[model samples]
Target: MPIEQGGRVSWGVDHLPYGVFSRPGQAPRVGVRYGDRVLDLAAALHDEVFAAPSLNPFMVRGRAAWQATRALLREKLTNDMAVTEAHLVPLEQVRLHLPFEVADYVDFYCSLDHASNIGRIFRPDAEPLLPNWRHLPVGYHGRSGTVVVSGTPITRPHGQLKAGVFGPCVKLDIEAELGFVVGTPSEMGAPAGAFEDHVFGVTLLNDWSARDIQAWEYVPLGPFLGKSFATSISPWITPLDALPRIPGPPQDPEPLDHLRRRADWGLDIVVEVAINGEVVSRPPYASMYWTPDQMLAHMTSNGASLRVGDLFASGTISGPRREERGSLIELTWNGNDPIKLADGQTRTFLEDGDTVTLRATAGSITLGEVSGTIR
Candidate 1:
């Protein structure tokens, strides 16, 4: 049997979890992952056989429904239920939505490696990290209105691409990242919630990039069209409450007094990326220079209100290792050297028809996977 966290069962190999939207004739609006199948959450909820008083309150609301749904799944699997006559649905039948409507979106460049690689290329000999980097979580507000679920195709965007020698480019690229969704909202004046409550869940994120276009336009205010094109996320969201609460040590060199969080503020979720069905890059969530809680605290420090459904992506969590790099620009060193894949195709940046998938799993519990075909 799996262990429990905060009175809820910890997700494990025996139990798989998923999210769902209601439909007629569906067993219930819930999805359970047993091996390869995506069990319907809606079906489980309606069935009196799977009764749980704890999950009664969250049966309707989208976010709460998912949370309660997972909690019960863990219980059922751990206890080993005998109801084998489930409505068994195909994994493809699951209609994956945003999991929750996003109220806001924020992206942070918390990886010093990513910042340094780009900074060195742009401003050689300059300090790679900004002075405020260690003191706070640096971020840019994103377009929540544009976020989409996995399997969505993103068109190569058009924007300014300024290259001194080569003139400019219409090229595009992808950035691998771990996205955090806000579980609870903060009051107008009250301080941000502790690390435990601020972060609700984790998902794989693919932040598409138009490198050439970005280079030309990102002079004064950072990324614009180069980034705003389209961002994709995996369908299922793994609530933070479901994973093991094993806390990691504080980030290196210790954070500023105000930014420092409790010892267990961060999780060690693994993040990886694939291109054309090939695993090109893989890295642990621990590679992040900062934690999601710190980012939340910093965002709310100025009294900026945080609302539920807010999506905060820990900026390309790149590490010092070469294979751990997250973006094409960084991986290829700004196109100076292209990465050759086993598939006989070399990619300095993303190409037309290239499909990229971002997948993350902690132990046997997956946060699901997000994939997009570039056109």
Candidate 2:
């Protein structure tokens, strides 16, 4: 059956993504969204293929299995092939949980526009970009243990800034990024092409920041306790195969053969950020300087290994326009200018009680909606 036959689900067929869900009395089970209900894949297939607490076991089966599951599920869903009412659960009645266990977390500064803007603001005296920025993807390892599923409240992190002043992160900011989930493990010496084979899907990630603590502690080492406090991600994982390809910009002074990804790494994901109920920014994912494949390639260039469920993030995807900025630091120019809100309020950074929502859409298929409130 064609996916087009299943009329307008919240995240329909093309988005045919997977996640973990639990009902009132049931334990977590892998499920797929179809129309306004969630189909219990395990129950529908009458097997334990999707019976795991997270989607890791199923996702680790590689792309062939992923396609098979999607095809079988799509047919059962679209044509009502073998699905029964018992296998379908109402979306509202079920609670969504973290879809995968993050074995490792890595984040990349892949957006040239975002990097350049931040560079000018923080290091105005010298050239905005470092010499090696364009040569390779700049990234740092992050705390995976603290990664929370969407809707989880982020506590205002407490830390020092300029010798114990303006603490509790007066500059509580949000970095809107698209994260890639690795389902297949890679060898230690794998090259950029390995990304195509290892990466499984994508998700919306919010790297909440404490700008003051980061400013004080970032030197010598990248980030520490400030960034480790909390990070939020969407519940659903959208497979890479479900999305269309939009190639990234050409690399000047071409990369080495090992780093060159001949295939399309760019994804035309439209990412939006909103405060309360008003939309603030809509940064285009295509504006990123480095692609996902390049980041994966560059990450392992030094003989590093890739693990299953390892999450890699594309940081703060800002665009050419002011309104396209992904972080509050760029949007409000480091609190000098406050952005006006819909409810007759203005904010330079997130305040307590403020709910921030990050959403990404690819055509009619929504990757996921990752939202959290500042506390």
Candidate 3:
């Protein structure tokens, strides 16, 4: 990929996101994504760390190593492209696998718009946000085993609709969100200013939800079967060094000292949601009420240790406008208002054959898209 005069491509060398790839007879190994190709990191760098099937080995090396490796990759890709060209593999000729092994999965309700919309839809007469919503980043533990790579087929999950009722999930939905990849592990205590140090990268995530099932079981505790069925994420993990940070949305009542923002970690990536090839929503990430740094601080404030490949996602990335809603439940107003597709078919939720794709971009650099079809 040729770097333009200003030094950026649609998917540029500056954004050399990493992932694991395999050819027909080869074992999976780490690679970096260039424009239309994957740079075999193991072959090009001659490092056995990149020869590992997952990114965990490289990620556990901590921040200093991470930064040094990134700098080296840029130098080689830009100035030494002629020598490194032989290791470049076309993206179409390889299979992309899950980039890292997930140690734990946590999803946060960080979007005020999504939370408010959902509250209004379900509790029309009550307050839109819960009492403790603004006070902290509300979240729930999710099943890490179910997390899968992009393009994996998602079977519609089944759960109890009411008491003693069980069947296929009729109100299947998608939550367009961004996931944070944890690199360095930390012992107990809060990581207030260590967001960039510990978080290695970001990835587009689609938290597939069963609205009816979620509504039924998420009363006292939180999500269970409705959410754990499947979660899809982009194959490429864009390093934090590549994303441009900006000021996040202002919090109404200031957060506590522990939850305070130490740095401008608010990412300005724009996320686009498409259903069956038609663009529907373009949810802005900058609009999220709670920043990832705060979420990290809150997660470890209670003596929770961070793991090498732990993944935490910013729950549905919805905006204030109707077109900016991230989930189908919010877009269609809990099935009361159905969205019309280009094919003239109105949809309240995902059908068995429908496909959902989420793409995101920060300025000129396009993040790898997470796409999945219902089976």
Number of the top-ranking candidate, with TM-score as the measure: 3
Q: Model 3: which residue pairs collide?
A: none
Off by over 4 Å in 1: 1-15, 21-32, 47-70, 84-88, 163-169, 244-253
Candidate 2: where are CA atoms >4 Å away? 1-10, 81-84, 189-193
Question: What is the total number of backbone clashes in candidate 3?
Answer: 0
Question: How do the residues 240-311 of candidate 3 rate in per-residue lDDT, one tens digit apiece?
Answer: 999989988899899999998988989999999999999999999999999999999999988799999999
Model 2, span 224-336: residue lDDT tens: 87689988999888888788788897777687776687789798888999999689999999889899988888888887887789999998999999989999999999999
Q: What TM-score does model 2 achieve against the real structure?
A: 0.95
Better of 1 and 2 by TM-score: 2
lDDT of 1 by residue, 1-375 (tens): 334544543345433544543334443343545544555544555664222221222322345555565666667655645552264455555555556667788999888778888888778788877677767778998888778889888887765456543432456778888888776677787567675565666778888888887777777998887788798987666666666545544566687666777656556667778888888777666767777778877888777877767889988867788888888888888888888899788988887788998876665455678899977
In order of TM-score, best first, we have: 3, 2, 1
Per-model TM-score, in order, reads: 0.84, 0.95, 0.97
Q: How accurate is candidate 2 locally (lDDT)?
A: 0.86
- What lDDT does each candidate get? 0.69, 0.86, 0.92
